[model samples]
Target: MSETKISKLFTELNQLKWSVVSKGVIVGLFAGFVVALYRLGIEFATEKSIEIYEFLKHNQEYIIVWIVVIVVVGLLIAWLIKCSPESKGSGIPQVEGVVLMGMKMRSFFIIPVRFIAGILSAFFGVSLGREGPSIQIGACGGDIIASKLSHNKLEENYLITAGASAGLAAAFNAPLSGIIFALEEIHRSFSPNILLAATTAALTADVVSKTIFGLKPVLSYVDIPALPLSQYGWLLLLGILTGVVGALVNKFVLVSSKVYDVLPAWSRPMVALLLALPFGLFLPQVLGGGQNLVQLSETAQMTVGVLFVVFIAKLFFTTSSFGSGIPGGIFMPILSMGAIVGSIFAQTLSGFGIPASSIAILCICSMAGVMAGSVKAPITSILLMAEMTGSLVHLLPVAAVAFIALLTSDLLGIHPIYEVLLERLVDKDHVNKKHDNIVLEIVVEMGSDVAGKKVSEVNWPTGTLIAGIRRGQKEYVPNGDFIIYHGDYLIVLSSEHELETMNTCLNKLCRKN
Candidate 1:
């Protein structure tokens, strides 16, 4: 190429790079403030919820008023769901659907709806977490900004991803985990553009969160001692136990919807609130997102029997509450359950002369293990747990447990929770929709039906056109003689009438042979 041509090309590339970085800053700042506000709201709601319960406990006459309040909160949640169905449940799957599939969300309505519903649901003592809603809110902020500033769909996707990472970072004060999650789980690639945007946004958001919530870790563990090599065996055993329990948790959560499907739409959320009354009055420790339960386990205040009971109650309640299609997340609840499991395991070993300090280590490791097994994001889980505890002294144990739990879940043929949830959402919302012209992106899995096949050999669905194929950082137009390889991202275009049929065919074509 000529010198002038090369210079012009480099100039354009530099401009694009700076443009994306600038946009990332804007997204990070906006999403950071929004999520920070969300965090404050959640804190207020949680404190008020406990205060109300305490008041009722002291005054028997006010019990009726509490019941009336719960019923009203339930109706309001049900109404919110009715008005914005997309805001129901943990917002992670919805964000994933938007990024992976070509699904669209009405950000203006979803943001406020999710914020209000999430706070109210938790305020009424529902077993939900605030992180999920914060993520959705951040993504919506990114989308709104990108929609107004940029015209390219590809650029918009990057901003949305950056927003998601920023949201998670602000929610938990874990910037690295947020960036890794965006790349590993959300984008499923290590593209340079995504890396740059995610890093910038996550760090910026972390700063904003720290400014408001201080520099302390979200779940602080003071002076956590490292485990000895001799005690590593126990971590493996704990991993296996957490793996089994994690699989069960995923299974129950998936079927919770089916269990509640028989109920009227408006009454679904109400059932969870009504059931919460008994637990709220009797065993309030298992209420909300179970943060207090984690504190109790960490301090070893609860006996083994009491820990087991709390675990069982939390497991059942979380599944039921989530199944009601309320605006909440299982992220914190799952971690809390893992803490209980670890406590029980440690207590069982204490009979055999295990040190209490080592048991505390197991509690932390098991939290990472169960999160890895259920979410199938081992790196994110490990980093998140470490960051939350403000210690990397247990990376080896954490990694070992996380790997084992992830393997066990895979052996059981279980999909990641978010993946399953996204599939269900798509099945319900997109299977019957018709579009004028739509583009679909499919990653060619190893051993997929079309892997290693020439363009002429594979039978593609009718009325669909292969627009392009992306391999590594390059894009190419395929010809009859071109061969498709595994890991290639195929961009297919179809008419409105053939959208659903094309989607099914493409999904099958992308599945493992």
Candidate 2:
């Protein structure tokens, strides 16, 4: 290597490094402001929701009035979905789809729409969480910034991740955990760029949020004794239980959604409304995000029976409300519900001579396990839980449960929640917009025309190209004379308009699915 070449490389590297830092700093500052606004929006929504709940609680004499309020809530969510369908559901999958689907469709209008709709939904006792929506809102902010900046694909990905990190950080007041959430759950990658961007975004958002609201753990903890070493086996057992339970929760949530799809669209909201009505009668605590239950569980204030009832009620309502297509998140609700179940399991096992503190330890571990299994992001699950509860000391137990729960869910063959949801959403969108474009994978079969034909010979559509081909286990950028062969897989990047024109031509030349 000549000194001239070495110096040139160093100069390019320095330029790239500086570019990343500059973009990250700008994204972080913008993301911080967006996160702070998002936090205030959630707080405002929650207070309004509590006010409505209290009003309804005291005005139970007029069943008609309660029905009107419930109907209004349902109608409001329906309007949001109808106006901007992207605002539906947790918004986590939408964010993932935007980043992964190679689709540059940015619904900038969705940010404020979702923020308002989500608050209304939760405030009116819809069983949902805010964290997922917060992630989507944050990502939207990042996406807008990325679009304005002149950057390559990789840099855009980094900026999007930074915004997502800030959103979670502001929502939970957990900066480090937010960074991990973006890395472990969203990007599934670790690098210097990601680390710097995620850390900066999270810290910046935390600073902004703390300036408005004091720095406090999301869940305030009481001084509780740590479990003895002798209870490690119990922790393992709880881990296994949480795994199974988490698997069941995921299964039921999916199944319930499918069931809702089979019902008439008009009846979906009605059914959810009815499902929630019963909670008003006997289990009002289960009607919302269950933040009250979370505080109670942490404080050891819930009785065994109360825990059991709350757990069951929460499980049913969360599944029902989410499955019905009401736009909301399940993040906090799942955590609160898992805590209830864990507490009950621990207290029950305590009768078998295990100490109460040990049972409580099992409860905490179980909560982490169920969260990990359900989300299929064990590292994020464990770290987020630790930060939210201010309990890094329980990392060992939490990690054990998280791993076991993840393994159990995998063995049960349940897909990750967001992936499955994305599949359904995309499928439905495809049917609705039958003319929409799709990324299709095609292979050259032995007897197909393209098997022996060169890329130049095939009547390829405009705006379409053979982006890449995998031939005999080797991948290559396909050029005009790239020899097409049997068993070679071709990735076609095209729009539906182009695809329609090329369909018959390609079918004669190759296999398409």
Candidate 3:
């Protein structure tokens, strides 16, 4: 209790914090290397697959061979998912389960299975992104290290989050977004420990990625001029459009999952793969992750009509591919669709006296808007777009659009895409329930039901206990009199048996009414 004693205690705690972050850096380094390798593998497989498609296009005689190859690849992907169910889909939900729901994943099995299956899915032209798999791979790497070196569950979770941060950072070469995403979306809190660890991990992983992929932004659009104040009205309109589209995309993704559920597990991928055949042969621009499609749109290679066709095709293909429960991600696919939407919107307004350069700016801003609407992470969307485009000149416009899109989506009562997916996965009990003690960190969104309520006012679940509350740099042991505000993080502790009920109650309390 003395001044010297308190100073010594603070110093020790600071040292301890840095030590954990140091471990995170080490985990991040390993995760970065693994994700880099995964990226290279996917790139190689994608190139080879495209080459095969080109060759087959020229030689109709080999069409039968290509069909057989796709079927076999489909079967292989199905088998991989069967062997390691944890590797299914984007793996982001599973990571969320691990960190928040006390879900367990077999790192040894999931790591390789996801890597191989993800590459194969991409190779076969499944409309998927590499970012999700990279995140899972990074999380697995962290899990492996934590299991070997740390026995504490809290520390292990931090490492897992760190790995996920590293994964996204390495995948997109956006360290800041990666860090913000891990906090704003994954952890859903601003814990000092999590921030430090995630930052170290993301930066370290970015270093590894840049060493191999160079220092260029992921989606480079140089010389993007800032939108004038007069054009602000158009940006708002674009935001509303993207918000509606994002909600529809979210609905279709869930609906597609249900549609695919009727089929036998092994047949789902086969059907989706077969569905890809026609598009692959006729409209290859919408294939794979569709990054090139976005680049093409940016260069105005496609007219409005053609952009619409490609958008519909990519949207449906992405929904189907994800619904089939393959080892893939919707991150890039969603972004690609957003780009197409932006292009179409820009082209439509070109006759209204909007300059070509302004159209391009609208296209760029809409991408962020759609992302924010769908993912419900406006900060991440804005920062990610800024990093991807390598220009912050349009930050105000991007932020405005992202905020509007998020508001629109919320008004429509559409849950964030990942949150919905996580719910589905959790309902199926994909997570291992061996751990009885579970800790959940829930963020209070600005307009959430509990945002301005006192601790005692909210109808918390019977068995749930508020372990602590964190608001910015301050922490508190919540009492009945304590008032919770927007941006405060509630640390709730509950048993596994009570998790579902607790989550239901928490959702009602936290979600925007």
Q: Which candidate tops TM-score?
A: 3
Cα lDDT computed for each candidate against the true fold: 0.81, 0.71, 0.83
Residues 333-448, model 2: lDDT tens digits: 87887788777777777777677665555656777788887888888888876786677788888888889888888888877787788778777872122244543445577777
Question: How many clashing pairs does model 3 include?
Answer: 0
TM-score, predicted candidate 2 vs. hidden true structure: 0.79
Query: What's the TM-score of each model vs. the native?
Result: 0.89, 0.79, 0.90
TM-score of 1: 0.89
Scored by lDDT, model 1 comes in at: 0.81
Worst 10 residues of 3 by lDDT: 5-14
> What digit string (tens of lDDT, one per residue) describes model 3 on residues 201-266?
999999999999999988877467778787788888899999988888899899999999999988
Instruction: For model 1, name the residue pairs that clash.
Output: none
Worst ten-residue run, lDDT, model 2?
Answer: 430-439
Give residue 204's error in model 3 in angstroms. 0.4
Please tell me which model should have the higher TM-score, number 1 or number 2: 1
Q: What is the lDDT of candidate 2?
A: 0.71
